[model samples]
Target: MSDYDFELPDARIALRPAEPRDAARLLTSYADGRLEDRIVRDLPQILAPGDRLVVNDSRVIPARLVGERLRPAGTARVELTLLVEDEPLRWTAFAKPAKRIGEGDTLRFPVPGGVVEGRVEARTGPTVTVRFAADPLAAGAMPLPPYIAAKRAPDARDESDYQTVYADPPGSVAAPTAGLHFTDRLFSALAERGIGLSRVTLHVGAGTFLPVKTEHLNEHEMHAEWGTVSAATVAEIAATKAAGGRIVAVGTTSLRLLESAAGEGVLAPFTGDTRLFIRPGFRFHVADALLTNFHLPRSTLLMLVAAFAGLARMRAIYAHALRHDYRFYSYGDASLIFADPR
Candidate 1:
């Protein structure tokens, strides 16, 4: 995993996205190690007419909550970022000051009508399962990536800024950042050029931000996230392939879900939890091209991109991005990588 590491300047991290979204710079990398610089709005020029863009349309919910934990001694400030929904009202969350929280302890969050309470039901290391007294969506804050959150706090604007223009199925705690660069105008432009657009849903989990702790990549445990690919979309993918159209996944989530649904070398309708993890040397079954944002150093996301774009080439690409001052991480610029045919 250390082989994937690269030096990134702190100044390259983007605190906010490009104002028009589509104005974000795009870096294109090809199978033969060729590179081009473009902008997000130039997708129509970058992609062929018959190519299809498979995007994740999972909506981001306000999953971060600031509350006070009621303990025997007194009340302590606790911040919770909801992860997977284990039950109707129960969510697995990462609690700040996890050591201070205990099973059965109640947390109170002040909201519009009344205070929403959550009682801790169980613990697995840093994660705790909390059953909410009311719907968390009503008062939860937007769960921003910690890298961004550490620099500044989430605000009213993030409720809109953090989500993609096409997001509809409200479930994910995190935004599929690659889709963030798209705008209504860009969508119209792509459609006008005959670039087909398809949607999949992957309720991105907060666990996506967790760092890999194992020395060997294979030893890392993948967190399960729910996703769905409709029968109609599967047919579209097949039709695209039949016509020699490229399957361009908009983000890692879409790529993972598409690969997960591809059993026996073909895509089928699917709706379930997927714990798929892509690393270098993994054979890709669906995506021919990928549009993604710059990822963290030595992170699984980077590994996945390396797997798609090739390791040495990805290193060169990242070095070029850094040299050009392209933004890094969730609010960053974009990259278009064509998979190696080999």
Candidate 2:
């Protein structure tokens, strides 16, 4: 855990995304310890023709809700960030002022037309299971990362800015930040360059924003995220590999799902929950290269990247990013890292 810790200045964090999305800076970190400063739009020139880019198509849902909890004395303001849907109109969420909420308490969230009501079904620590009278999407707001939300409120711009253009399956509480750099114009360029594109689904959970609480890496337990790699995607990746092409994962989410599905030494269609905690010394079976964002210090994401590239190399890369004034975190700059040879 100490190996992953680093000092990052607060001003380096980006509050808003780059204009046009593809204009964000990209740092190419090579296994040979070479680094190149580039932009997101340069992907066509950066990647080869036969290379396949696997992207996560998981959509960010408006999961944050501000409501009032009915109390015997009076109503108290409550906040909930929906984590996962257990059933139709039923969800597990993290409640603010968790001590104030109780089982059987009614939650009322005001929406455009009216209020969306809910009943607390269960509570465990700060998290609660609630069954709503109707879909809460109507009253919910975009759930921004805690680092960003602490600074500013989620607004109209975030609704479009926080989501990828190809987002289809609505489940994720957070955006796959690396994929946020892509746009239609960039997609056209990749397509024209003959770089094949594939999609997988990994509903990024709110756990992605949680901090590493344990002292040692092994002591930390990862939150299970629902993901799927379909048969079509598996075939595409296999064909790309057979043709001597690289599998470039657009983000860690896609990379994790691909690795989870390929645990048998060969890629197979997979659909289920995954709690894959990738730290240093982990073996790589898929994803020849990775395009991802600069993660927080001591974060699981940073550890995974360190595992993919070498730890020393990652430290050097991060130092370069900081020295060069590169933006950090979600809605920040990106890094395309080529994995160390197996």
Candidate 3:
């Protein structure tokens, strides 16, 4: 809400991923306010031995469902984006044509095996909670981000292209995109360079795309997301810090989870829901540097980067990115940002 805004050219949006995952462009913003252009494959040259790169392993689930709301009058087409699960069979979702739906109405979704259905239990605006008779995961399609979805329909290629190679825990509605640039070749390259890797989990929710509505950023209701930092991951972070190695978060999800686990002091093991809303003036306790993609304008993700690197510095970085016509959004280029000492 705080004037965190900008304009981006349409051509800057990347409709598809880079041919070779490692071939994507990378913008490096150093602590001294210097910017350098590099490709994703140059990580080995940018990072030194002992530097640990923390990544999110949460897999993107095909959570978008196309169904019909059946009633005595007629059937109405409905689209749902599953947001979060409160129970094994109950989930909160964003529904299109939500106004036409009422409580207790059945929604039928077709899938490969058979038809799956859910009953709406409650509704609050566009958000609805539904209890499914059968698992909806099997019937859903990859919930592509609005920006990408606006450009093209989700195809079979996206099933693999949108996910990271390390994705394991199946819960997120969207990909931890920074992880998408990685491949077996990139992993081997990082390993040969002595760069260590660690993982955490943050089931990214639908709220990631919700715009900041309040004029004051603090007044915005940050959506809570489930995440976990095991004792092992914390140990790895501590070892990296102790060894004078930089802890490089592979994406904002990893960085946010680490900071949420750290609280105000030292990094620690944690597992729970985190609604941590980072902005300017927020102090970071874990990540020494971050490897993330160019985010949407005025988005919380951009604000988080502004907080990690300085706001003025971030503006300059984005200006460069826009001027150079670097690809943007989920399938776009990435940036390696170092926190300002100040």
Candidate 4:
């Protein structure tokens, strides 16, 4: 775990996303140990004509909420970030000031026209199961990563800035940041270059933002995220691979789902929860290349890239990114890493 740690300056954190989306910087880390700096729009030139880009199309919902716990005397303020829909109208959420909330307590969240209410079903640590009288999505705000939300509150801009242009199904609480770099223009350019695009679904949970607290990597437990790879997507990938095209995962979420579905060394249709943790020594059957954002030091995300592109290579990539003044984290620069053949 210590080997994955690196010092990052506070200034490198991007408070907001790049305008036009495709204008963000892109760092290409090749298998030959060469690094090149480019922008997101240069993807068409970087990737080969036959390569297929598999992207996560899961849309982010308004999951962060500020509600009041109706009390006998008055009301206590509580903050909750919905993690997953355990059942219909029942959600598992992480609550701030959890001590103020209890099982069976009523929580009232303000929506556009009226207030929506919920009853706490259960509590475990900071996580609580709440059954809402109405869909809570309407009463919440976009759940920004804690690293950014701690500095500033989510605004009207975040409702769009935090989501990807190709977002479809509404499930994820957090956006697949890597996909945030793509725009309609970039998609058109990729198509013109004959680079095919495919879609997967991975509803990112709040657990993605949780820091790895264990001293030993083996002891860490990964949070499960719901995802699916349709039969159509499987056939698309198979056709691309058959044509000698590379599989370029647009984000870690897409990579994880593809890898999860291909666990038997064959990609297949899948729909379920996955706690697949990609670290060093984990054999990868899919994802020839990965286009992702710079991750935090000692994070599972960092470990993942290191596994894809040798640890030594990823270290150099991060060093170069920091030295060249590239931004870091969710709203920062992107990196296109080719898998290490070794």
Candidate 3 stretches with Cα past 4 Å from truth are: none
* Candidate 2 root-mean-square deviation in Å: 1.0
- For model 2, the superposed segments whose C-alpha errors exceed 4 Å read none
Worst 10 residues of 3 by lDDT: 1-10
Over 22-112, each residue of candidate 1 has an lDDT whose tens digit, in order, gives 9999999999889899999999999999999999999998999888999878999988888878789998988888987899999998899
- How many angstroms is residue 285 displaced in model 4 relative to the true structure, after the best TM-score fit? 0.7
Tens digits of per-residue lDDT for model 2, 1-342: 778888889899999999989999999988788999999999999999999999999999999999899977899999999998899999999999899899999999999979999999999999999999999989999999989999999999999999999999999999998999999999999999999999999999988877698997888989999999999999999999999999999999999999899888788999999999988888889899999999998888998899899899999989999999999999999999998675
TM-score of each: 0.98, 0.98, 0.97, 0.97
Worst 10 residues of 4 by lDDT: 207-216
- lDDT, candidate 4, at 161: 96
Clashing pairs in 2: none
Preferred candidate (lDDT higher): 3 or 4: 4
For 178-236, candidate 3 gives per-residue lDDT tens digits of: 99999999999999999999999999988887778777888888888999999998998
lDDT of 2 at 168: 99
Task: In model 4, state the lDDT of residue 165.
Answer: 95
Steric overlap count per candidate: 0, 0, 0, 0
